[model samples]
Target chain A: MTRMIGAGRRAIAALLLLSLAACGAQPRSVPPPAFNSTDVMFLQMSLEYIRQGEQVLTTAQTRAKNAELKTLTAALQAQWAEEQGTMQRWLLGWSQPLTADPSSGAHEGHGDLHSLRPSDIAELQATKDNFDGTAEALLLGHLHNCVEVSRMESTGGQYPPAKALAEQMAATRQGQVQRLLKLQTGSTMGA
Target chain B: MRRRIALALLSIAAVVASMFVAIAPASAHGYISSPPSRQANCASGKVANCGDIVWEPQSVEAAKGSKLCNGGGSRFAVLNDASKGWPAASVGRTVTFNWVFTARHATATWEYFIGNTLLASFNDGGAQPGATKSHTVSMGSFTGRQTVLARWNVADTANAFYSCVDVTIS
Candidate 1:
């Protein structure tokens, strides 16, 4: 009986190993047409960008000196949050991994959070004056980056859903950029 | 004994399967190379102390209008500092901008800016760009040392990669 139990344990271990090996085996003999690394990179980066934008806008919503700036940040925060949800859903539906291996060196050339670094965020939080101006500048930079990346995905991305999302983002953000520029110049009366 | 052998074979198969999962996926993207953008210079070792950008020259990214050196990260912020004396490329009134792409994407436009003024704009529409493309841009009545901010805008996505070229107009 003791010997039989030991054998069963070994069998379980072996089964586990085999299952792992099976997973390692090519899931298909031929590669399926699906999301490649660029697609993945675009999706991942887009999500990150939106999340970062949300963070900055949230800060702006409360601290912005200008009522227009506060209103704009609140609207932007909602927009980005919705977009973030869409990206996450696509990532899930496509079965594409959400995060890239940072060590894999795959994320090298991709643009990331340049507009609002942690220090910049801290500074914005610390300063009671010129909060609106700083928020406007950061948000403008953020929107511009979004437009560029969305354009890339719309043109270059393989996945159709991602491409569509990119297109939508570009158009929406471009409009936002125009609005932001108007606000920056204190020309919010017409907008 | 037979069960043990079967188990051992299964383990081997699992190990092999795991190996396949461990393999990295193919990478594709685009970046400017000619006249060497800051990221390109760092990747090619033309610039020293480049930080993370040296590995992925194509990844110099940030908010579209953000005036950042290393795309936005502090690690590559050295590219943002103008006083670092980045080497300037000598060119005529019209110069060709070369783009190296790992994967082709639908393009919106290519914009070149000097300070707040736009120097050139090329409309690509939504056509998929080739792996390599060159555009001859008129420097637009500017002479002397100028920094050209070249932006490649993708049609579908909401971001653009930026490259700053230090050029001496002849």
Candidate 2:
């Protein structure tokens, strides 16, 4: 009977060992951070463009003559400000820097930077004539860039929450583009 | 009597240990849940006598190129059992399978198959996907009860996840 108890203890130890083996196979407890380069790049690019957009929206908010355009700018400022906060929080959680790396050349090249650029914001800031037209064009270009970054994130981003946000942003920006087109009467809004 | 008690105690300890192992974390895991795949049903208790897979429904992972529902993993081998007569969800010609992911991994391609015939495939071009993705697949002339095996090929890894949804198409 004593020997039988010894065998029982061995069986229990073996089971415990098996359980430990299974535990070893499990994903680590330190947290699984699965994010690709696209996820990081999208957040960085979006933050840069949205930061530039803040100034453009502020200009539109104060200087616009068109009533509907004023209302649109107000809406965009609030929405983008909230989205900016969200992206910043996510970037912090991912341990990514909020500022874009100028050395990466990701924001370089005419094709990549065509939609939103610092010069575009300056062009809007310095424009003395047709402020609304310049703002409209800049905002249109900014919106297009937002949609493009959103598409990139939705397709190539690994994080679920980030991808979900990207998809939502894409849909929202597309709708806003349509609205802006209706408000734009000049050739700049024709696209 | 003491021997019997010891044996019973050992069995109890084993059951408790197994239970603890079942709830461990699974990263980058996903499974199609709309039509209730074999593992989903097991997890939901809609089906019984299913081994191991009822614990981690999102972990039916194995190497790529397996035609089986569980991707040929022995841990989820019960999923490949055709004699279990898994329940089929009734759907239309254009059935959209909603893939509910616990964690979304970077993906290469999403493919669906009915037996030897390939139903449809979507190329992700080595991109990461969202938590819950949906694909609308046209069954075309195929009708009656069939098991649609969906495979997600991970871009970074050689492994892929498998989910077998039994659907009754009209």
Candidate 3:
């Protein structure tokens, strides 16, 4: 009995020491790595569409062609008006002209309303197309990431806005993938 | 043995709890770190610093000529951060007032007023060129929206210069 007690004590001491060692090791404390790269890609893609729309508006304004201007204006304006609501909610808690800065590098989620110059218009269009493609790619990528983020992880303690935004992006991007593909196809045929 | 188990579990729980608590505030939405530029003078042939003027009706509905604020006889406008009514209507209230005023003149003493009411008077003794002061009042005294007035009745008008007034009502 004495020998058994000594062995048990030794085992417990070893277990306790192991636990302490584990505790002492620095936790990797990883920041929830922001939404998967695809979410980021989609956001960037959305932002590009906004920029492209602006370029199209600027072109119409410069050309001063009434019919073309009206069509471009209506389409660009309609899309932007809808996006404004989304961006506002994403920026200010309630929307309505209030502007809040997203994190430093996370501005892929905001709108660009600053004035533009004629010289930069061409480059802006190119960027817009690039972004449009990227946004589509992100939509293609979202299904895999969404399952991992929503189903794999415990949502019990996730940040409300972050989680809500992820869900929104997931739904919106899927719809956008279909619409944007048609738009892209149409635009190519017209070109 | 049971006591030791409980203590060990308690320590582990405490560490995890503290770790989560420490990370939360950092993850909250970020805030604007700097204020917009402050206007130095309003009357230098410059259009009223479009950035400085703050009015609520924002549209045509700003209580139809409500007294926004008196800049002690200077020009004043609302600082975006200074607007009131959070978690409620931003421009729906019928009575809310706040003002920040700056003095452009040096003087021994000066009095500020808003329609028969004394807001703040200062005796600068030897105060500098641009003395600034702020006063706030609840609009419970006034009934309907009226053209609220503010003035800087200076002890020495020669030395007194004014900025602008920014007032918010409702």
Candidate 4:
């Protein structure tokens, strides 16, 4: 029995020593992280879309005939501006160029996900007196684009946080789309 | 004879339990790994004079909402020093930030900021993340050398993890 007790004591000491050494050892480095081209392109293009959509917001807020549309536009401005800032940081952190390389044929499989060009912005401004009509149409298209790019990111993004945000982005933009469609219906009836 | 055997067995069990207690880690949390935060740099031996943070990179945590790298706590306050000249990773306009956890904790949101402007935030919806997490952030129009403060806000607790990464965007 004495011998058995001695052996058990030795085993415990050895186990304790091993655990201590394991904790103290220089940590072996793990590979950084996994992020694919899709992750990169999605973020880049999303920023462009967000910036372009922002231009119409001030116009909508001041000029929309529909009260809900004007208030919703203001709310969207605050929310999307924050998102734009978030995407910008993600792009820089990944070490990719801030400006997206959409025209380079690199974003091949991703569907048409660009924001409204200057022409669209120009047209939006041209509808100055009746901004609600053009605002509804232009923003509806932008929100659809938001959902598209967000969908692409959700499906192809390997970065879990980015994917999680993409999912939330899709859901929010879809909700916004429904709201805009309702406002458009009401505006058309009033007109 | 039986009582002697019982006492010996009890002594052995007591010794083993004490060993296990000694081995158990205290407050194993997490810190940023990529673009290597200040604490991470200290742990990796990339920077010197890091104090206790060199051993416990994951414990640079304190209550939420402090702009300081150490969350305004005294234990890891060396991270708040601006003169350390920590090596800044040369990155483009966009970069992906990654993190490694010593022990996963329920997370609320991961936020990044430059100066007073919030660069980004990734919401976790009160979920326990894996051992690692990655966030792709755009620097936007921000250029030149900048120190970005990254934070991990815990879901259930009032505390959050803090890290600062210096970067020169070329």
Scored by DockQ, the top model is 1
Segments of candidate 3 deviating more than 4 angstroms: A1-53, A56-80, A86-90, A93-120, A123-173, A183-191, B1-170
Q: Mark the 10 consecutive residues where model 1 chain A has the least summed lDDT.
A: A106-115
**Docking quality category of candidate 2 according to DockQ thresholds:** incorrect
Going through the candidates in order, their DockQ values are 0.03, 0.01, 0.01, 0.01
lDDT per residue for candidate 3 within A15-67, as digits (tens), equals 99998877656343743232222222233334434553455455444443234
Q: After superposition, how far is residue B136 of candidate 3 from its true place, in Å?
A: 71
User: Residue B150, candidate 4: how far off, in angstroms?
Assistant: 0.7
Candidate 2 Cα outliers beyond 4 Å, as residue runs: A1-30, A107-112, A186-191, B1-170
lDDT at A72, model 4: 83
What TM-score, to 2 decimals, does candidate 1 have?
0.44
User: What TM-score results for chain B when candidate 1 is compared with the true chain B?
Assistant: 0.79
Model 4 residue A160 distance off true place after TM-score fit, in angstroms: 45
Going through the candidates in the order shown, the clash numbers are 41, 0, 12, 23
| Global lDDT of model 4 | 0.70
Docking class of 1: incorrect
On TM-score, who's better, 2 or 4? 4
Q: Which ranges of candidate 4 are over 4 A from the true structure?
A: A1-191, B1-24
Q: Which stretches of candidate 1 lie over 4 Å from their true place?
A: A1-33, A105-115, A187-191, B1-170
Give the true-structure RMSD of model 1.
Answer: 16.9
lDDT of each: 0.63, 0.70, 0.32, 0.70
Residue-level lDDT for A142 in candidate 1: 60
